[model samples]
Target: MKILDKYILKTFVITFTSVFVILFFIFILQTVWLFISELAGKDLDFILVIKFLMFAMPRIIPLVLPLSVLLASIMSFGDFAENYEFAAMKSAGISLQRTMKFLTFFILILSLGAFIFANNVIPYAEFKFINFRKDIAQMKPAMAIAEGQFSDVGSYNIKVDKKSGENGNFLTGITIHKKSNNFDGSKNVIKAKNGELISNEKSNILKLVLNDGYYYEDIIPKKYEERNKIPFAKSSFKKYIIYIDLSKLNNTNNEDYTISNTNSMLNISELKYTIDSLENNRKKDIISFVDNSYQRTVTQGSLSSNKALNDSIITTKIKNPDLLSNFIPKEQSEILQIANNSIINTNYTIDSTEQELESKTKVINSHWIALYDKFVIAFACILMFFIGAPLGAIIRKGGLGLPIVFAVLIFIIYHFVNTFGKKIAQEDGLTPFLGCWMATFILTPIACLLTYRATNDIGFINMDVVLLPFQKLFKKIFPSQNQ
Candidate 1:
């Protein structure tokens, strides 16, 4: 590298590294705050928390890199201008473009790094981080137990009174209450006097080894005449095994598997997959609705026939009261009334199913649209840079204060426009891709204009007129703005 090229490259690297480190710290702090909030009552080790953050860094780096590049380039170039380094180079016959050559190469290298991180590392990290969080949440009971507080591990609620012996590995005086309410209005509560949690690593089952406990069931009799309490007392066995449902923990594996199943981390491809899946689901739902509607039509027709039959029977009985008493018993009439009520209930159920299916279809469609929007937002980062860099040069104030303010204002405007477009797209049937890129498209021309004006020294907006009111008045009176 030439001496000047090396000098410029060093400045670029230093500035970019500083910005990246600052932004990475900021990302870490925000992530930690969110994680702390989420894991507030749960028990997680400090090492695991640190690991989670470390895994998250790769994902955050790609997002921070591009912005860091922009900031670094602008700062380095502005410093060169401020220090009269550019004038020195110009005097030596080096053009402005020549001065920027090294910086551009640096940017290209940074861009390539960002592409690798985004495509390869970030996706894997995201998948791992998510799974780690889920595992931590699932194993919270083992990690977050207090001496005298009730802790929920999966479906079972356990309380431990004392912890001692060998680094608190053994939990003494443990009480567990297992409640299952799956059946219609039936509850089973198992109370264990002394239980130790044993996790089988191979099978992933958390076994509650109960020393002495009783199972109590309050059964409502089928006759409806009496309620009975059935109790089973522990006698022979020292330990009773209550298996924790490992299926709940295994459910997250599907999401992990799905993430790992795909090789490419392209946002557009993911969006397309989501759209296709949603469309297929929608089609299935439509078919289900049609089948349900057909069934409901048949049921309604049957119910109408039943109603007519009952009406006919009542009319005939009313005409002959003596026959009603003799031919139809009082119990038979009551049974008929109950049967009619059941038919009415069946009609209500069909109506409810239809409504639920309609609601689900709408939700699925909304999800598909949302995925499409996210795909567009991912690409907008590249578009935003084209606008941000040129605007920075035109503004020409490279201190922390003005650059930050400018970046924030520009970002806010972009975010607001993008959000507005999404809302319109959702409500009306506006194009999803267009809605997402609207802000980028609108600002791109502005960026180009700023770049042209800065390069050519067109002075599109005179700063002196805005800063000094007298200059504006003088220009208006004299009719020669430049003079």
Candidate 2:
């Protein structure tokens, strides 16, 4: 290796390392702020907090790594250009491409490493992070029930006005909403003047003993007309006890934890498998629904009866518009009621099926987006480097001033576009492939343009290209003295 190549590589390495550490630390703080609610007001040990942060730290790499590469590239190359080092190299017949050769190779290797990290490390971290989060609630039961807000624990959403005991076990103004098993929303409400939390470290159940409480449960009527009455059972109690299961909350070690249902917790292979199974299940569901709907709404007997009715009506000189006239009055009323009920039921079924299918489709799209994100992170490293290196060279400014500004602006645009694309893709507004690569596609051309300009020694922006038309328009309107 030449002395110059070594110098360039060393310069970039130092800058990249510094920038990466700073950005990574900043992002870690941001993550803490984002989840501060989970940490705050909860008496958690220091070791558990450290574990939470450690598990969450890796997921920030995709965001931090690219920005680091970008900022470092801009700073290092801008410093070289600013100091006229590039001029010395150019005079000695060292082109920009020749200078970038070693750095480019390094970035390619970094990109590959980024891909491996995204596919393996990030997913593992996400799995551990989520399970760790759930484990915290079980480890410290008070964490599961925050003061003054509803906290979902097992099948109940518990809220307390205040907690006062040493472990924050004694509660005041406790309210609990027991979630329905069939997603019918919370129909049972339990309110207490005060409550006490009792738990054993070795046991998986937390007992909530309430005093001066009332249990109110709504009783849904089977008849539609009776529903408007809103019949409910309300009972006052001097004391009530509720037991919550914490057994399944901290199953991080279970072998079945590998098949976590969240899109972020799965690697590329698992995501692919899950997506395929979900799509196949959706297709099967649709087919079964269609078959069931067909049998319910359109039967061979109904078809024949309808054909006979139509034939009889056609034979008359004036076709009877009132088809129900052919039936007895009693049968006519029964037919009308049955048809109305069938139509209502079918409409309800259709709406439910549509919603279920839409949900399943969104989940599938999310999996695809997750799969594509692994590759996107890898590509982003190279893309950011190309953009930053050229931009730095063209700008000819170094240090934390202009380079930071440019890097921030470019990175913000990239982040915004990526988020927008992911949101659209998750909602099925765009295909996952296009959505995941949208930012990359948008920025690649800009990178190429910047690289070309830097290579040929052109300015970052051609002022004439932008101002020439305006200059011509002014000349034509004002009839310039020279003209």
Candidate 3:
């Protein structure tokens, strides 16, 4: 590498690394706050909390990388600008555009990293993170069963009288109250002499092994005339295995799972199958609707023809009573009425089928829209870098305080607009991709403008100068303003 390239690379790496670390910690702190809020008033495993952070790192990297690049660029360039290194480079016949060539290359590399992170690493991390949360939730019973407190675990309320950690297991005096609303509102209480929680890791089963327990069930009598004293069953056991259902811990491949917009995370074959299935479903719906409409039309014509025949026969009977018996028989008239009724019933069935077909078409359209939105979100990461980098250069503030605030505010605004657009697209018949990426689309031009202004040294709005007059006027108007 040239000396200049090395200098730029070194500065970029240092700034990027420092900013990434700071942003990562911020991300962790925010995640911890969110997790704590979510798990508030519930017992959570501390180890799981750490596990969540570890799983979350990959997902956080995607978010951090773009902003890190933006911040690092601004800081590195700002440092150059502040120290007159940019002037020195210019004095050495190096143009600003040429200087930016190195940074642009750096940005390209970072963008590729972001893409890889988003496409591969982030998806895997998200999948694991989601499963980790599910595992934590499944382990709620073991976590909730604290010493000397009643904890509701699935269908049973269990209270441990004493608990002690012994040889990689928990030994406790367990009392269980199992209530079943299914059995005409009955309550069963089981008191055990002693029990130990034995977790079989291979099977993912939490076994509550009880020794010497009696089950007492209180059942409500169906009738007042009948005796209502429910007999409690007492049974002494050497050991009992109350298996905790950990079916939730079993990992299942979610073929339909889509992250961002890339279908590569999903089984591509499954996505293709899904698309094909939806297409077939749509075709079927259209065919069904057409068939039903045709059937209804045929039934309507038949019903009209029958009514006309019945009207003509009645008119003939009125015109000549002697010829009435020859014109139409009583049995034949009854048959015509029944045929008309049958046609009307057939028409009603066709109408119902048409309504169902319409509904299915709407559902198919919704899924297509959802698929489109996913694609937009996946590609928006690249757009985000373009937006962030130029904005950073325009702001010319590289410190943690200003850059962070700027990044967060931009993200928040972008997120809100994007979310709102998606909702509109989903619910209000807006274009799906357009709705999902409207924020990015709208901000691109703004970013371009910022880039242009920054490059040309065009002065944009300065909040510091804008607020300075107000600050001075406030001090003059109110002495307490200074205080």
**lDDT scores in order:** 0.61, 0.89, 0.63
Q: Which candidate achieves the best TM-score against the true structure?
A: 2
- How well does model 1 score by local distance difference test? 0.61
- Ten contiguous residues minimizing lDDT sum, candidate 2: 300-309
- Angstrom error at residue 46, model 1: 5.1
Q: Compare the candidates by lDDT and give the number of the best one.
A: 2
Arranged by TM-score, best first: 2, 1, 3
Query: Model 2: per-residue lDDT, tens digit, 412-433?
Result: 9999999999999999999999
- Return the candidate ranking by lDDT, descending: 2, 3, 1
Q: Which residues of candidate 3, in runs, are more than 4 Å off? A: 36-52, 88-93, 136-162, 167-194, 198-206, 210-241, 245-279, 282-395, 426-429, 461-483
Model 1: lowest-lDDT 10 consecutive positions: 257-266
Q: List all candidate RMSDs to the true structure.
A: 8.5, 5.3, 9.0
Could you estimate the TM-score for every candidate? 0.66, 0.80, 0.65
lDDT of 3 by residue, 88-174 (tens): 886898765666676677666666655555545655676667666555544533554655767656567888776665332454577
- TM-score, structure 1 vs. true: 0.66
